[model samples]
Target chain A: MSSTTVDDRSTTVTPPKTRGAGRLKDGRQRSPVAMVVMLLLVLLWITPTLGLLVTSFRTRDAAATSGWWEALWAGGWTTTNYSRVIEQADLGTAFLNGILVAVPATIIPIMFAAFAAYAFTFMDFKGKDVLFIVIVAVMVVPIQAAFQPLLDVLGPRGLGISGQYLAVWLLHTGFGMPLCIYILRNYMSSLPFSIVESARIDGCSNFQIFWKLIAPMSMPAIAAFATLQFLWVWNDLLIAKLFLTNDNTTVIVKLQQLLGTQGQGAELLTAGAFISIVLPMIVFFVLQNFLVRGMTSGAVKG
Target chain B: MTYSHSTPPVGGETAVDESDPRVDDASPEATVPSDYGLQPVKLLIGVLGVAATLWVMMNLFLAFAYHPEWFFDSKILMGTLGLVVGVGGAAVLFWFINVAIEALPRKLEHGLVPYAFLIPGFSLMALTLFYPTIQSIHYSFANRDSTEYVGLQNYRELFSEGAFWSAVLNNVLWIAIVPAVTVALGVVVAVLADKLSASSEKWAKSFIFMPMAISFVAASAIWLTTIYAYQPPGAAQTGALNAIVQQFGGTPQSWLSIDTARLNSLLLMVILVWLQTGFAMVLLSSAIKGVPEDTIEAARIDGASEWQIFWQVIIPQILGTIITVFITVVILVLKVFDIVYVLTNGRDNTNVIANMFFNEMFARGQAGRATAIVVILLIAVIPILIFQVKQFREQEATR
Candidate 1:
């Protein structure tokens, strides 16, 4: 009814809105001022990233000799740093390991959270309210506290769960579940009840309703949570360093070692940083549209 | 702009017949079997799960007792058992809860479903999060190696130590500086980006948002290599900042090493501001978009100056979002480790609470002091955490 009402209202206002042309004239007059302000803001915002990019491409010699902006006219660009980075550092292996760790780390939490969120939003059970509150409240517990205990559990002597991918995966899932469920539950709870009821009337079981109806409908939220988790895991250095051993170490941990204890090896650092940054950039670019749509869809009911 | 896709017919019209046999025509009632078989099935699954858990436990005990060498030799057997039992038990419990919810009456079912979904996550959180938090507080009162209970000694030492005081002061400086600068820069960018036309706006926002995807460690490495990186004067500088100084015939300086009182620490703060700017930009950008159009129009109609309108009308409307972003940044600043740890390793007066905690705990093996530092951090963070939770709830309610 609201959708139809909005459509009808917009249709009636169209011809009159064309006749009210003063707004366009006023907007056009302000355009130049707006453009200048925007350019300045863009310049300010991009300065650091531009500096990093320029420095990454420059020769270590050139980079050490001048600011990145000086390279604009100097024409001293070289791919030698990249070559040295690739040759000297095991970036290829690190990149593969990062993907290995990040993909499952992202997917597992999302899968678990979605099921949990659907149950939280749509189902009724005893102690449901208290349980949901407890989960949400867990967001306050700084993750660092869990590091030692989880390490003990994953270590050689305690739980004796050493040198295993599943240890890290399960820990990541446990850590990620709280925020993921909080966000996804909030989103799923706001979905129209009529649709769910109709699905039930159509003899859809709860799992079928979740799989065929809720999952597809909640894609935007899913994508948002997945993107956030992917980035968090991809960028994570501490967890990987602590839980994963030498061979299974993620890109960030490898980069930390490559940078070395005293922070030498700038060439390797730059290349390693770039290698790590590329996937998240691609993910962001691909999912950019869904991001804004997802945020509003979940956070705003209307 | 519109292309090939057909719009669905409107006015609540039924486009398909219900009698079509291709589709399942069973009503909700018909779908439910009269035999009530689900309960028995659920009971069977639960029993199987418990039995399997018991079997694994028995095998583990036998291995530990009789075949100790075999147990010691086989890593895969131990890991596999742990996985099957842990993951399997969880899955079974989840399924049982689902079945129970399905068995409930409609009104009760609706209320219970969401909690069922939340239980697994909550259980995990309770174990990993809440348990350790309580444990940390307990450890704080113990001796250096946690071998003896030295009640209040750690806390007393924490309050008395000069480095601890310096850390407190530095954290205060971080809390004061990082959030204010980040929020201000973010608001300015968000406001300016909002004024642009659609095409240019996305590009500008993307540039601002790009840094956000970078891991703190990677960003720190990049900054260390390019910006704050300094090489000695004679060695042919490899850092970007030093290179620029060399080109200008100025002596190269280690920007991170500068102990110009607190300026080196300030440089570390700059890196945080750079990393967080993107986070602030995205949230503030959305908040700017959410500003009621009529308010801006009214301000303009009143002949308010552009600056006045921005500072007065726009700022007031988005103050809540601003505080939300600010508080989030504050919490992040409190937990900041990668930058300080990587860049300076808490050397040259850059030590904060988190780095101190890590250094004391793992490096020095002073678990009591480390736990004390963590408890301090937890105490400091509690108010901000409360505020954040409250803000999130309020925002949710408004939505």
Candidate 2:
């Protein structure tokens, strides 16, 4: 942030010995130039989201003729869009369906991945390294690859489970595994080994150690994956469109459907998008630390 | 091989508090191993007992999943009850096996426990992830409805199609622009914000990070209405850009539908850049903090210019992080669907691979074409996967 002029007074005062804390205020950012540039960029980054927030509250007429900046001073608002989304559009039902989709989709993979992560980290098993590598390698396999095969397997001949929430649930369970397992494995291995050793010497079985010790001890990692999976499931459209029928629409697909001819339901769509995002935003702010950790552990390395 | 612990991950500012990891286990019983077998009578009893438990659990799960009519025909009712029974049933199954293992000779318990821990999770993966992956590759070779083996016909047609090539070109354009621009902007913000006071840094970073929490569908709506929205020449402009243009005595333009120089695709790219810049910034900001402060101080005291220190000392220190963020964002951009699907539905030169794949599969009912697209997408990701694995190994080795 050194903002002081780069010591033109150098000839006047060279101090007896070098002081690490120079008079120059870290000029990279201490200057007003840095503050203005960063703030302008930040404002530019959020303008779209902010525009929607403002426009969502304005009346349809007000939103069309003028910008969000103008609507602030003119003072016009309506709750009709929100009401229409909830009552007439059946967004509430879709939200309920979203819960149905997101809950099991989140818990199933996390629990399953936790078990796999525990065994892979704390216990010795055959083909462990090779198996773990294959699983993690598939982490990069985009969700598109799994959809066609899933359709066949869940078809009448394979399992006859299509159009069922259970089918979608199981699809997410499988699809979510590689990343969740990777995150949990990294976190579990970081846990103190002495805890496992002491518990082992105390005559606790490996199953007991995993369930009683590792599962609870890995709560941060577990929470990280849970937040991520929940957001992903809640926000997902591709998986829902491929797996669920029209009768089983989640909130996201419902919002996409609300996009009438050329987004004619701009008001309703705007409010509807808000309704879909509210839950995940709440989850994100509350567990952002874990989200950051889980994301880095799974995708990025030091 | 020893497990890598606490390698000081980006954003994981606090390392695990472990002075001594598990090399200290010296117990004699832990060292003793036993062959895994029970007597015939015990084995028979255990197998039948576990089999009965699994059979009952399966029936219960099926009943909950299938008999929604009895549960008032509510999907929520069926889902909740099924989850309860499924999870409760699983816990009971695990407890049952643990008790059975305890009944066996004590030395044999260790041999079986690890496999026991692995069974449920691995089975789920086997049924869902592992099986579907193999099946998807198989469908890539079949005909449209997947009823016959076409033998590379789908791939041949896909590669030759104009629409397919357009999708690929758009994908390449998006991947080329979005990640590079996002990382460049993100690094600037991260470096600038780091130089600010702590409170200002937090505020500025949070504003940039706000878009990450919203869904892409929602993000598309925000941009579609607020920025890229269009109207007829006579009507009032709803989109902010066109409105501003009109206010400045220019013509209102349909931003997303405009075709001069592929402006529509670039418009779609802006939405992604907006969403991902936040993610890049957060990770890169944490990484900036991880750069040792004393090194910068040394450079400063040695009369190095701020630009010189940033270029020489800071950027090199965080190159690993820049690559990590870039790759993550690239993967996201390659599968970019919701934005295109929501805003333009891949119309007007905005088609990308994922959107094309979805349209071919669902709208056109071409399963073979769809799976072929999926296989292509999977193939595109393999080099990145190899790079990721190499990075992971390097991490392990360095740790």
Candidate 3:
């Protein structure tokens, strides 16, 4: 939304120069204490995930007998846990279902919101301001408000789409629309309107202007929302749990199921946890820049 | 002012006047601008055509949505069919509506076309969010299955339950602690990371931010097995905290079961803090980076220490970002369910309102009370909603 300001702000960041004896030209000392504290905090943050990652490779006996650190020091690791978790937990199907649910859920809303955003940004319509405000206000409404009723609406007696992937897809698209429209509209508004004006002057219709002019220009914001939505849907458990039955459960749900109540099958859980997180972790690192931009621009997810 | 295209503007004079220089010889349809007498009929026909197309689209969509078992019994096939019909069909709908709006009388087309683009998204919102939200509130007043009206009985029952109050208190603790602590640590990480060499900063931030990508269920699993795991006094401790405790000649304690004074609840809050601190850092880091370097330079020239400059100079500049990050996290915390759901499922008095709602509705089948909890949650969020609208207006002002 604040794309221009973000660009301006980022460009103004001071380029790093080599620090000799921890001093910068700006009179701010680069303290070694800060670096050490930063490193320690970083270690503290990453250790939990690292421990599980290590344990995921260890055998059940070794994991029960020793800490993950011991396995790290020794050379007792195997790929068996992953394979067993996949086979026993049926995480393979869940992983596929995660993809099946996430892709359309991401694209459908973005497409619809992009068109709506174009109208909100470039066209004059009655009640546009009020409608835009309503969309923004929807950003804060907890999805819980729509939870039970959406179930009723989509259940067999209503639309008969419950337990199917279409149910969650529709729910995700609906829940995602506000932020999508908000982000894309903010971005489209920031775009230079002269191009749109010229296209309109050349007798281009609103549809033509949206497709030929605004859509290409809004790619950065679109990509940002797309990445954010995909991740949110993939990591989501609440909506998926409430909507999809066991037959179409996503990976996150399967991981929870595999954990069991008393934390039975800890071996499988340690491995299954890694399996569930791997795709999202990959997506996060690969799209880290877009993720940051999307977050800063008010892509809040719960 | 121009009609160089095919169709004539409805209920208007001939579009291509010989006196006008914009007359087109390029397209043959432009020569038929003499059809002005029947323009209203064309407009009627266009509207009816678009309406019928919309009806057919809805029927087709409902057919696909309602009967997946009929579509060869594979969700993949039904999903593909639904996606095509849903997305592709909407595109076609918008095209048809815009085409119909082209024959909208005179300047009405100008005003109507935007609505054509807006119909699908708003319709979806109306169905999925707005209507259901009202239905939820209505069901709060109704009986369990929403079959009969029961007034405020659900509210009274929920307010009287100790478990509900415990959930409320735990939620209060979470709201009071998580957002503030996450933002504080985030600012600290952002400032500390900013001082390092660029490569070191990237690696450090990556470690801190890495938790954000994983699901809360996975996060809970990571912590439950790695950090919160416990064993008997003599058995070797596998969990990190227990192992460290045993190394100090102390008994290994079950961290999550220590609910005395809500310690376990506080421990569960740690997982959310760990997961969310990275989000806060990324936002605040950019805010920190956005602060003009010369301001810090000027603060230093005035003999202020780095701490003083950070407090007096940098904090003021990034206050907007801090508030933004703070409110966002607060909203997230208000809806906190997964960590609690996966870790303890509200056992040992760790219940939050969201988990309470989940158990009440799905686990216990108390739809009335569940909707009541949601209504209460909605009430709690109303203030934040108003504040956010104000905040958004301020941001829009700056824009």
- TM-score result, candidate 3: 0.91
Error of 3 at A102 (Å): 0.4
lDDT of 1: 0.69
The prediction achieving the highest TM-score against the true structure is 3
lDDT of 3 by residue, A153-192 (tens): 8887687878778788888999999999988998888888
Alpha-carbon error at B310 in model 3, in Å? 0.5
For all the candidates, what are their Cα RMSDs to the real structure?
8.7, 8.1, 5.0
True contacts kept of each: 0.39, 0.56, 0.66
For DockQ, the strongest prediction is: 3
- Candidate 2, backbone clash total: 8
What TM-scores result for chain A when each predicted structure is judged separately against the true chain A?
Answer: 0.84, 0.85, 0.90
Ranking, DockQ, top scorer first:
3, 2, 1
lDDT of 1 by residue, B1-399 (tens): 111122122323334333333224354532333212224444456456545654664455334324536757443454354445445545555566666665543444555566656656666666667776787788888987666899999999999898998888889999999999999998988887666645576788887777778888878877776566666786666565677788799998878778677988898888888877877888888888788889988999999998999999999989987886787678778888878877777888888888898788768878888888888888887786667556666765686
TM-scores, each model vs. reference: 0.81, 0.88, 0.91
How well is each residue in B215-270 modelled by candidate 3, as lDDT tens digits? 99999999999999988887888899999999999999988878999999999999
TM-score of chain B of each: 0.77, 0.85, 0.88
All candidates in order of lDDT, best leading = 3, 2, 1
Top candidate (lDDT): 3
